[model samples]
Target: MTAAPHRPPGAPTADGTEIEGRLDEAVRAVRAPDAVFALSQDGRRTVRCGGTAPPPPVPRDRLRYELGSASKPYTGLLLAELVRSGVVCGADPAVVHLGPGRPHPRRSAITLTHLITHTSGLPPLPRDFYRQGLPHWSTNPYAGYPAERVVRAFLRSRPAHRPGTRWRYSNFGASVLGHALAAATATPWEELLTERILEPLGLAATALAPAGRPDTDATGHRADGTTPVPPLLIGGFQAAGAVRATPHDLLSFLEAHLRPDGTPLDGALRTVQRPVLRRGLGHRHVHTLTWFRHPTDHGPMYFHAGATSGQQAFLGFRPDTATALAAVSTRRHTGRDAFVATAYGLLASLPPLDRE
Candidate 1:
């Protein structure tokens, strides 16, 4: 459905041609306001697509997109590094770092592992978050959240289920973990990530919270695709859902996860992808750090998808084939499904690995 391509549709490239074609048609198929995609295979070889149609690609490396909860894996990777350095262990309860006082054991029993895997039984958000944040739905929802308030919320609330008992996505849990990691290191979360993960990995373009570089950021589209949505700042809970980066930055990140050599965090990267919890019926899939394992005809894929108020992002890698893909779109709600389908379709188009 894309504005007709001059090249024959689905022309061959080193990257899967059929998938690339679908990637093009998909944008027109769903009529996205704007989107970008990147794929990597065999560690270094990379292919990227931008624009609503195909040719005259936008600058993939400089056009920034809000990563949303796609940022969680970065946090997970940092936790993996801390584990390697013996700075913190996943099994250790998160309360070890909360300051000013200790929380009651019943309320503070959640561990770093529980937080990373979404098994802490905390709700998708803290109860107070929406109560206080809804007024800012069109502005910065988390503009005023602070460390003291976060600790107070944890200490005062009761877990929906016992820690590590069941899976429930919790932005609150991740924020707590991020805060704890920051405290243990005696550095702010953004600075801690920069020194330990972003800098060491050489990902200079990735932007966490408190970083405002509008010159490079993309404009988000609302459901109608007419009015533009302003940039969102995740404030104190940034580690849970606020990260912005270019498609090129994500391509480098995917390569690091699949092939960790020549990188400083090789061991931690490998560990971050290992499955820890068998979730869902028949245990057909597992949760690894912040990644989700879903069955596909080719094999099991470990991936994560994120949505902010105005943006959507999908990042996935076939662990068996070491093929990775990242797709980001400027619109949210229905637009999310558009490119999510594009990304998964691309993955399905990948030829299965030839096992000896």
Candidate 2:
């Protein structure tokens, strides 16, 4: 495989060079294979850096990168739509939607809101999930597993804690939510996302296909820096981290979330972004139905990150300023503090919000 072409690193025009240089240095320090960073305010005054990837052949608008957990917000958005349509309630017991196959005595107490907030006491991933013998950090463990296997495993698994007692990231919880969404809508999960979310928002490049559905996609890289791996095919886990999208497409989605008045899912987007829980140390921060929120000098900021076998991606926005940032890296880097810092640094360079 060849590298994607390199775009000049700097501001949108002449004034952005300083901020662009900072982004370039940060991205370089992580040794990312390919990256794209952009900061925007009032839908203008944007600065962009880096190419899709280095040299071989990056598609023009289709630099597909696995969305990883970044796919969470999209799932959250779908749930929010369901909420708006009255198909499901954020605080309703998940068991009601999941049916009787699984003995979730406590499941009836866990709400869709708790799952999205990561407070359902579900572990980050299934305990036996690693027993399949895939590499610990393999970019695509679920590539070979089917949804039936996942459902069966989950049906017999025990909850780690009582519902809503505490917060624990749960890939299983998200997957379960996806299953419930499909069951309620009576449509395939991918098709529901396309019809209700992606298509409506004009996210033509975003989808749940693994190995990406031809055209737009970022190739996965191995930890050792071997040649890029084939696009990941994470079957049943698509709802957890299987999306492939570009920074531009993601930003449009973020804009719609931050400013929903004229968007396709206007009211639903607003409901999803509203704070529902206190998270992080000392509960100093707040979390919405799907997005994490932090207080900024300007106002509250919302964001999320994603990681797969060989890729990492981030998305964030400040509603008060109408500013947002989205980034993607072709190589894996688990330490996300640096990515968050880079995002904040980029946002700081933008014009401050006119209010608040």
Model 1 worst lDDT run, 10 consecutive residues: 1-10
Q: What does candidate 2's lDDT look like per residue over 52-143, in tens digits? A: 35543654334766778989999999999888988877787666656656566765567777777787777777777777626744656776
Q: What would the per-residue lDDT of candidate 1 be over residues 1-356, giving only the tens digit for each residue?
A: 11211223343334456545655665455555677766666554444445442322346446678888888989999999999999998988777777535455545678888888888878877788887789877556777777668767876777878888888888888988898898888898889988999999888888775344445787676776556677877867878887788887887888788778668999898897778889677997688886887776545787888877677788888755667887887776562466677677776566532222
Task: Report model 2's TM-score to 2 decimal places.
Answer: 0.86
Most accurate candidate by TM-score:
1
Q: Candidate 2: which stretches are off by over 4 Å? A: 1-26, 45-53, 59-61, 102-104, 210-215, 335-337, 348-350, 353-356
**Residue-level error in angstroms, candidate 1, position 330:** 0.3
Clash-forming residue pairs, model 1: none
Clashes of 1: 0
Q: What C-alpha lDDT do the candidate models reach, one value each?
A: 0.74, 0.71
| Candidate 2, lDDT over the whole model | 0.71
User: What lDDT does candidate 2 reach at residue 159?
Assistant: 73
